[model samples]
Target: MLEEIAIEDLGVIRSARVPLSAGLTVITGETGAGKTMVLTGLGLLMGGKADPGGIRPGAERAVVEGRIDLTRHPEVVGRVDDAGGSVDDDGSVVVVRTVAAGRSRAHLGGRGVPQGVLAEVADELVTVHGQSDQLRLRTPAKQREALDRFAGSEHAEVLSAYRAAWTERAGLRAEIDDLTSRAAERAREAELLRLGLAEVERIDPQPGEDAELTALTSRLGNAEELRQAAQRAHDAVVGLDMETEGSAVHALEQARRSLEAVAEADPALGEQAGRLAEATYLVNDVATELSGYVADLQADPAALETAHQRLAELGTLTRSYGDTVDEVLRWASDAGLRLLDLDDGDDRVTAMRDRVVELDDRLAELATRVTAGRRAASDRLAEAVTAELSGLAMSGARLEVEVRGTEPGPSGADQVAFLLEPHPGAPARPLGKGASGGELSRVMLAVEVALATAGDEPVLPTFVFDEVDAGVGGRAAVEVGRRLAQLARRTQVVVVTHLAQVAAFADAHLVVTKATGGDDVTVTGVQQVAEDDRVRELARMLSGQEDSATARQHALELLESSAVGR
Candidate 1:
């Protein structure tokens, strides 16, 4: 329910603060007095589009604020609580919107919120019915939805069943389409797998063979250089002395003997001579080992060639894997597993085909069930809507619902249509062709009433009807007023109407009047009327004369009679 509306610098409403209450409240004014601006303010608070033109001339911005009560609306409360906001014990939710020439912003519970989020939350709180509501009856989808609500739980159950079935069918069909479209591609992939596997098999690569071959190649490639260096080193350490006619070991032996003869004369020289003799014996042993090394030093060319050929074979692996033999060997092991799977392609295809067949059968069965459920739901919906038309003063009118099977969609395969007949013996046609504006409004009202009954959210504690009485008066106007009051018992209702009959039913009456100060055109004030004032106001509405006693008496009787209706 809207608790209050505050408007600033918006058209004729320069600054208006209006307090609202529960039950039927009326706002009455002369033409151009800016009653529509009140509704416009509410629309802005509901996140409707804005225009800078709505801002008063010379004003930089316009601001509108709506304070609403949300006692029974826990969904909204939960959202606010999640965002670390608290609703007062009185359960009031404040929504404010401001429009500047440059931009607009929305505030919820004193926190800034995106306009789109504001709009979504507003939809949960209010449903505004205006002159355009009558035109909505012309749409087939709206009519079908109205009938479904009237049909109650049985129809809803059928719809649920139908939707479930339709979903399964749609999923199966989509999968089949995707798989069939890719069949040729899969076939090509299978052939490529076979060729790649065959090529890898022909290589017959051995793991770790590259490491052994690398070591052999190193030794063989430098064999000549290694042997020559070894021979030269041996000749330096133990080769024969050419001038002495004997090896180095024999010359050292003769020098040690001459020093031994002088050592007996000098004790220190004798010890040195003994050390030289031991060194000479050790040198002879080393020379004998050198001779054996020379005999084994020759290089083999055939062995070098063999090592080069093995290195070339290992090079083939480097191109496929990393630039090394270890990596290629690992790749071959992985490729073998892939080849095994490709070899079993026929078995895989058979399994996939069987699964597809099972899914297709399930989809067909579901489609049939969906079609049947939709038809039943359609019949029940038509019956309920036709019953409601009688109470809306369209006794002769008939409503028909046509439900037909369609291709599967996200919603289901049920396509619904609504048709109507305005008078007895008239053939039923689509709503747009059959009902006049007046009839359409009543039909829409009836539909709204029914749908509101079935709605899950608490009915807004207040309703504001803007000129819904257009093209209607007399008995029809009184009926509209009576219905508005009836809705008021469950929720507060505010209406702006030109008809006196409608005004007579308001629990509180407010008259909006304009005043002019200098060149300023302003909607100056709203006055709450008392009983005596209400009688005079109703009299003036009835005959434009508060002075007429007869008109006043008639107004009293109208009020009394309306009380009885209540």
Candidate 2:
């Protein structure tokens, strides 16, 4: 429930606070006293579009703030929390909206949020009905929604399941159509994949084979040059003629002999002679290894040709698949998997078609259940709404909910319509054609009250009626007030009305009055009237004369009668 709304610098309401509570609260005022501004403030809090022109002259911004009690609406609290906002320990949240310079901003639970968040939260909190809603009630979609809401939660679950099944069936059918239409295309693609896979299998390239073969080919091509270089090094290390004393080995041996002879005179000389002997051994080992290398070196043209041919085959695989042998191998592995899937296309399509058929049967059963539920709900809804219409002074009017068969859809295979029978023996016609503006208002209210009473849970935490009694008056207006009080008994109701009878029934009555300053600047104020003040306000609303004794008496009588009705 909305605890209170504080509006500032909006239209003629420069600053005003409208207190609200858990029962019917009506705001009454004369024609230009800013009564609509109060609702405008509520609209802004509900995240409606903000009009910059509604801002007061000389004011930079317009602000509308509301304090809502969420103790009974934990779902709304969860929404606020999800938007990074927190509720008070008492289960209350403050929603604030500001409009300035053609832009709007919203804050919930003191946390700044997108305007859409405010809309989402507010949708669950309040349902606003006005003259426009009366016309909306004529729409088939709205009529169906009303019936569904009356159908309660169990029916809602069925509808949900049906919609899910419908979506799945639609997807399956689309896939089946695609597969059937592209049969030739898919066959051609599978053949191409088969050909490519066969080629890759025949070549059978291995990872790193291209690099390994390149190295072998280079070695074979330079075998003769390598052998010549190795021989020259070998001759230099030893000597072409081993008998000559010009080789490194002979020189080192001569040095070792001299150093050893002087070793007894100098111990350091002995260490140097040992190192020279080790160096001579290492040189001889290298000369032996070099001779072996020269003997092994051979230009095998046949092996070289075989290596070149294998490299060419690997290159062919790389050119079509990847930049290297390893990459080609990966492509082959992926293609093999794709080929398996392609091979199973017909089987997969047949399975999907079979599933679609199963889904069709399931959907038909659910749709039948849904249609049966709707028909049953529509009867109850029609009877209940008709009962409410009788209380709204349309005792002769009856509402009929018609369920007709239609193609299966997300909602179901039923097209629901609301028909109105103006009186006995009158043909039932669609609401738009049979009901007057005043009758539509009553019917819309009847539907709301019926919906509220149909379900275990209340329709919403709060309902705001913006002159739902626009064209209603006399005893009918009094009954409208009574019915509103009845609804308020179950949930909070706020009405912006000009009828004294309706305003008199409100547990809380607020009056909007316009005052002009010495400078001739006009402003409006909203004050909750009480006792004699309430009577006088009602009197003023009754005959445009608060001081008239007759109107006052009439207003007093209205209060007495409404009290008895309550």
Candidate 3:
């Protein structure tokens, strides 16, 4: 709901604050009093195209600021928050639009934002109907949305199911396309993997095998040198050659005997003799192991050749797959898993194809149900709106809602068009094709009133009608006012009208007056009137004179009649 609009330097409205309220608020004024400026200000707040030509002469800029209540619109609040804006403590937001030179700037909740952000937030909060404005249901998509909303929650559930299935089917089709397009590439990849796996399996490389082979090859290459060294050491330790005087074991025995002979003369000598005896035993053990080493030392050429052959084979496997046997084994393991997936490509595609078929069938069923629901809603909506048109002085006019089959999409497989028949014997035509401005306004009002009572909550919080009472008078004007009031019962409504009958039905009435200053400057101002003041304004709207007793009486009667109707 809009609480207030403060406009500055816009057209003839130099500076004016228009206070609005719930229910229907009507603005009435003379021909050149600048009543349209109120809606122009509103249009700026709604992110409509800014017109520099509309700016007041000698003024630097034009500004339009609005205070909107967001208590019932959490989605709009979220959008403002996302745009780095905040809501007021009273659950309201301030939107300001400033037009200067040739550019315009928009501010929301005290934060500067792009003009498009204002439009996005306003789309959810307000709906405007005017002479040249496009109807909300003008587009086929919007018509479909309105029909679906009228179709109720059960149909919405069916739509949700259809969308889910459609999304899944699209995904499966993409996967199938990818698999089909890449079939040859995958086949070649699989062949390469198979060849690599065969090579690895043939070699049967094990962890640490490369290091083991390296050690064996080193031992086999230097066997003769190792044997000679061991034989010379054995001769030195055990006196195996007589030319070696006093081997290590013989020398230790001589020392032990000398120490024992002296032990009887000195006790310290006995301890030394015990140490020599331990040394002689250690030397004898070493000499025995050395003799065994010399006996085992021999070079085998055949064994050496076999170790080289195995090492060469393992080296070949490492150079291609990895730097070592363990790394090669890891690579082979990963390749084996990849090969399995590549081998199953055909089977996987077939499975996904079958799933897509199932989804197609499911979507077709849901689309049919959705189309049926829309057709049913179209009939009821047409009947309700046509009845409203009769009350608005189009007794012979009828509304036709045609639901035609089209290609299936996320919405459905239907195209909904709202056609109008002006009177009897006239062909039904699309809205705006043949209808005059006044007829279109009345039709739009009827449609809105019908939609308000169509068992779905109103989509917007406020509805504004400019010149809705055009070309209407007498009981027909009264009916238009009543219908607007009816719509206001469910949402806030603001109308700019000239008809006294329409003005009488407003919950709040504002009169725009133009004043000429001593400097010869004409300025417009808005003032809310009530009681006798409102009656005088309505009288002025009824006739050209507010002081005429007859006009005042008629205005009073119109007010009374509207009250009773409400």
List ranges where model 2 is wrong by over 4 Å: 1-8, 17-24, 44-53, 58-126, 133-138, 208-308, 424-427, 432-438, 458-462, 471-475, 489-492, 504-510, 517-519, 527-566
Q: What TM-score does model 1 achieve against the real structure?
A: 0.60
What candidate 1 gets wrong by more than 4 Å, as runs, is 21-23, 71-92, 111-114, 132-139, 164-399, 424-429, 432-439, 452-464, 489-492, 507-510, 527-530, 546-548
Clashing pairs in 3: none
Screening candidate 1 with a backbone cut-off below 3 angstroms (N, C-alpha, C), the clashing residue pairs are none
Clashes per candidate, residues 3 or more apart or on different chains: 0, 0, 0
| lDDT digits (tens) for residues 1-566 of candidate 1 | 77888988887777888778787888877788888887788888888888788987767999999888888778888776655456777998888899999789888888887787667777667656565432434565655555555555665665566566556555655665655676676567667655554544565556677777787667667777876776775666555452343556656777778888898799888887888888876776676666676677567678878867766766765675557666765666666676566555556656666766774665566556655655665676556555666655567777677776676554445566777777788887876565555666555555555455553433453456776676776776777777777667667677887777778888878776678745576644567786998888788878889778998998888788788877
With a 3 Å backbone cut-off (N, CA, C), the pairs that clash in candidate 2 are: none
Better of 2 and 3 by lDDT: 3
Give all candidate RMSDs, comma-separated.
Answer: 12.3, 7.1, 9.6
Top candidate on TM-score is 3
lDDT (Cα atoms) of all candidates against the true structure: 0.69, 0.88, 0.90
TM-score for all predictions?
Answer: 0.60, 0.72, 0.74
Off by over 4 Å in 3: 182-345
| Residue 538 miss distance in model 2 (angstroms) | 5.5
Q: Using lDDT, rank the candidates from best to worst.
A: 3, 2, 1
